[model samples]
Target chain A: EAGVVQSPRYKIIEKKQPVAFWCNPISGHNTLYWYRQNLGQGPELLIRYENEEAVDDSQLPKDRFSAERLKGVDSTLKIQPAELGDSAVYLCASKGNTEAFFGQGTRLTVV
Target chain B: DQQVKQNSPSLSVQEGRISILNCDYTNSMFDYFLWYKKYPAEGPTFLISISSIKDKNEDGRFTVFLNKSAKHLSLHIVPSQPGDSAVYFCAAGKSSGDKLTFGTGTRLAVRP
Candidate 1:
């Protein structure tokens, strides 16, 4: 009955550096999602995966952002040449398509 | 392009009083609505949810009221406490299993 888990709860990187965040969804949950939360803003969906298939990623910045959930249970989100504007919290969530549970999130600060 | 909106950037409520937070959505296709509460350095936690079919749903001290016709929904916290101070986000889910669209959060400050 563990909740969704994410790694590197906090990260600080320089502008134009590459950064990656990881997530492990709850056991038996088929739906996984990654979201970005800027200061004073709600979490925005970057990508959503249903058992290794990316069902939605329209919000992801394809030019520098890429995600994968090939194994389905765990997923990774990466941003290349990160910009200062990318400084925000990356939250990982899992659901049964019924209820969502979020992880502690990886807070990235790009200077 | 922001479909879900929480116009109130923040709210200050005295403890032990009712704390009401409001949200509005433009998309009529959104059938499921949810509320999430988050503290600093943490992810959002589900507070309550309501379906389009129901006008209200209640759990303990938290209640969610939906007005589909007006495209408005609200969360009422009775006897608010200091612990209730956090950012609350309202999200809408489409009927076709599409991803949720969330509003800019509203920060609630309950003064003791």
Candidate 2:
């Protein structure tokens, strides 16, 4: 079975520009998560989805960050008017019975 | 506040020796813990996990020890190999399927 898949392994955009990242969870996995990892730090949860519903998203920056999981399979995370501090690796993961598998992640560089 | 923390930013061990990475969590509600290994430009891969009910869980070369009372956990790799060099992250959650809180990773360098 294929693991979680994320598009755009790397992305570079100027500050104040809009950028989007995409993810496709593993088959039959009902739980999906989006995390951002800054340099020298661990991945922080941005949002989580259980089936098509976003069950947890308190950590998400509502002002500029938005995420959606359609049909509970694929997800998209968007950042509008990006800032230099937004540069980081965006990781997507899906949970099985116990373990959560991660994708290669999309590295975003805001210049 | 960071719930999970790995104090050691990096560690070096000679090949064929043992490598121990430590982690501590502030959340008492976290009942399950896991360790993940990552390489450059790659996502973390699940290494091993242990439940609150058990104090120790051992795989072939990796072992995870959980101390529920102290809220501390550790990962031990025996006879470390050069290929084992990578960043290791410790994570905790309410349960195995719950959302995880991760600690700043510890980069381990196994010198052969």
Candidate 3:
């Protein structure tokens, strides 16, 4: 089976511009997650979805960052007025019963 | 606070030798642990996993050991190969929670 898929392997935008990343989970997977990884750091959870409901998103920055998984298959994470600190890798992953699979991720750069 | 930590930032070992990576976590509530391997410009792939109920789990040449009393977990690669050169991340998750907390990761280099 195919692994999780993410769009736009790389992205660059102005510091105050808006940016979005998309992800398609594996077939029949009910769990999806969005994480951000900084240089020399591990991936941190930003949001998690069980089906179409967001079960855990306490780590997400509510002010400018938002995410949705309306169909329970694909997901999108958005950052409005992106900040310089937002430059990092955004990874999406999906899990079925045991292990979770991840996508190549989108490297976002804010200048 | 950082709940999970990989103290060693990098490790180097000769091919056919054993490579051991350590991880320490503070959350006693975490019941499941996993190890992931990542190459450059790619996402992480699952390597091995261990549940809190078991002290060790083995798969092929990779083994994961968990010590609940010490709150420590380890990944061991026996007869390490050059293809094993990659960044390894240790992650922990609770059975009740949906999120998984990960350690900073250790970069391992297996010399041929």
- Kindly list the per-residue Cα lDDT of model 1 for residues B1-112, writing each as its tens digit: 8899999999999999999999999999899999999988789999999999999999988999999999999999998999999999999998634677889989999999
lDDT of each: 0.92, 0.95, 0.94
- Give DockQ: model 1: 0.74
lDDT of 2 by residue, B37-63 (tens): 999999999999998999999999999
Candidate 1 residue pairs in clash (backbone atoms < 3 Å): none
lDDT string for model 1 (A21-92, tens) is: 999999998989999988878889999888999989999999999999877789999999999999999999
lDDT tens per residue, model 2, A1-111: 888899999999999999999999999999999999999999999999999899999999999999999888899999998999999999999996878999999999999
Residue A43 lDDT, candidate 1, scale 0-100: 84
Return the TM-score for candidate 1, rounded to 2 decimals: 0.97
Q: Candidate 1: what is its chain A TM-score?
A: 0.97
Q: Each candidate's DockQ score against the native complex?
A: 0.74, 0.85, 0.74
- Per-residue lDDT of candidate 3, residues B19-93 (tens digit): 999999999999999999999999888899888999999999999999999999999999899999999999999
Question: Which segments of candidate 1 are over 4 A away from where they belong?
Answer: none
Off by over 4 Å in 3: none
Write the number of the candidate with greater TM-score, choosing between 1 and 2.
2
Which CAPRI category fits model 3?
A: medium
